[model samples]
Target: MAVRSYFLDCASLRDYLQGIWHEVAYDGLNSVVAGALVQLAFGVVKQTESDVFADFPGQVSYETLERIITRGNTQKAEKEFSAARHALVPDDQSQESDEAFVDLKEYMLSDAYRNLVDFIVDYQKNRNGFPTMKMLMHTTPWDPGFDLQQATKEERLEWRRVYTINWLYVTW
Candidate 1:
């Protein structure tokens, strides 16, 4: 029998993170920031599908949804999660010392981004028994193809033109 790997769909992943988010303190990070970080990680993994998926069949299957469910010692998990979120906060000291502007784009490339990726990767890896396929985040010039004029006001507010796609693969 071919060993199958389990993976979380976007919704499942979002739900799992929501549970974590609720357990942890905001620590200067809100749900939107957490969600964006997750999407960015996904995008990084998607970019590597060509290279990573070559060993397996091109066809993909979803793992059982239950695998993504968050459970146990939520209080402890919350504390750890809060710490990770806190790590992502832009250093006010840097801004004061150098008068440097730390923007969202910079945060995507910061140590906090790395920690968030590590935290998510570790959780998913342990929870689903999968290994990290890829984790990355990057920003580029806004795509003109996403015509803001054509988007509804609500859509424009919710739209992330530069979001990343995340993927996790496991071999059993």
Candidate 2:
């Protein structure tokens, strides 16, 4: 019997977010912010795929299996992201040390990130289901645990970088 297939491609997810970003204008939101949020969402989905499909056998394709098995690559990407995120702030002062010294870039990025998540939730709620691959390449349900509200400047920056890497990997 032929195996049933369902997969989410990074390139497709990036494109979908790009489209939404273009059409919708959330306060203080832009393409870069949208891209970063999309990356976080992608990571959340990818990280949870195992549990999401635990009950189903042979549902995940070989390509997905290969991607999942390369845990080292994912970890490396995340570490690179973390470094880039930390580099956004001053070395002399930590982000937590000075709430007054608000990094406008980080603030804007975080707000946009939260707004995007709310948008997705609303979209799903209205549709009464998760989007299909054709509608949006999201494979797993949107995880509420992926919150960036209290995330430090470095963490937010890391999420952006991760998305950027995913975008490049998918496009090229």
Off by over 4 Å in 1: 1-25, 62-172
Task: State the local distance difference test value for candidate 2.
Answer: 0.46
Error of 1 at 102 (Å): 39
lDDT of each: 0.39, 0.46
How do the residues 132-167 of candidate 1 rate in per-residue lDDT, one tens digit apiece? 344323223335477789988544433342232122
lDDT of 2 by residue, 73-109 (tens): 5444333222223323655754433223333223224
CA lDDT of 86 in candidate 1? 22
Deviation in angstroms for 85 in model 1?
A: 21
TM-score of each: 0.23, 0.24
Q: Which ten contiguous residues of candidate 1 have the minimum total lDDT?
A: 61-70
User: What does candidate 2 score on TM?
Assistant: 0.24
